[model samples]
Target: MNHDAYPDNYIRGILNSVKSIAMVGASPVNVRPSYFAFKYLAQRGYDMIPVNPGHVGKDLLGKPFVASLRDIGRPLDMIDIFRNSSHIMPVVEEALTLDPLPKVIWMQLGARDDAAAAKAEAAGIKVVMNRCPKIEYGRLSSEISWMGVNSRTLSSKRPPAPTQGMRLSINRMSVGGGDTAASDRAAKNKSEQS
Candidate 1:
């Protein structure tokens, strides 16, 4: 898997197959990129578990934070790393220890460790480096165009509307304000509907 040029299908396949994500370096603060990414992925219907040692026992988008991936106590489909490039190796090492290891290791934008990615892939876990799942989901789903961001590949045909329970609301009120309570309620509503 070349991190430099990932084929669209390879990226889309991972996104479509993953169901649960453990976000390493997740933040309780709403303004951070990690917070936005976490909220975005959760809203898209992925079971998002926040992993942050400092915020352990605290809540993010209504889910309690765990100190580490090992504390999740359940199978995870992906590990979305929000930590620095220098920190990825240790996290990958920890991820490999899980009983039913995650199917993917995704390093967030600006976070990439070639050595760590190699280790994970050699162990049979798929790796996506220096990419953000939130952005990838939007781009693949053609939802970014709704925000006026050109996704480059255009089609005359409109993408199908997301199913009722899976509707995506990219309204500034829902995303930019950093309102956890509203975000949590929205996530809860989405889950119940699902």
Candidate 2:
């Protein structure tokens, strides 16, 4: 498949066929898109493994995080990458070294490395560039917000929304004083419940 243009059918096939995904550069911070996307995929019943040197040995959503693909020590169906274009080559090289190479190499939106993608494609590995698997899965499955209305069905009880004071707390927390605001929120939630 062309690295620049993957047919929709091919992309859909990969999404439907794969069971487990190793997410490289996944961050623990909930604010990051990588974290949200990874969390979303995991919640949707896909086996999502986080690979990040910084968080190696830590657990994200109960799945153990490994530092690199070589250390994962198991079969992976795909590697959904969140690293920069310049950093992708090494990851691809590592993936190639696996005894049974992964079926797909997915580069996140605005995260394409053409040369690296081509190398993987040359090895018979499917390449998906400049796209996010979470978005694609949700779109193709119609599991959530199919109309872009931000309304999605809940599998369980929905969580509370951020308070209106969330914005003020966000600004204050950026400068390192947000714990106090968070405490206030906890009290507010407790009071409202009572």
Per-residue C-alpha lDDT of model 2 across residues 69-146, encoded as one tens digit per residue: 998899999999998878899999999999799999998976767789889988999898777887766544434444
On the 0 to 100 scale, the lDDT of residue 21 in model 1 is 95
TM-score of each: 0.82, 0.73
Please give, for residues 1-194, the per-residue lDDT of candidate 1 as tens digits.
Answer: 76665766777778878899999999988899999999988888889999999998689989999998888999999999999888999999999999898899999987778889999999999999767899877876667868975443445555467774384433111222322346435544553454
Candidate maximizing TM-score: 1
Looking at candidate 1, what is the lDDT of residue 157? 55
Among the numbered candidates, top lDDT falls to: 1
lDDT of 2 at 168: 11
Can you tell me which runs of candidate 1 are displaced by over 4 Å? 156-158, 162-194
Clashes of each: 0, 0
Scored against the true structure, residue 93 in model 1 reaches a CA lDDT of 99
Candidates' lDDT values, in order? 0.81, 0.74
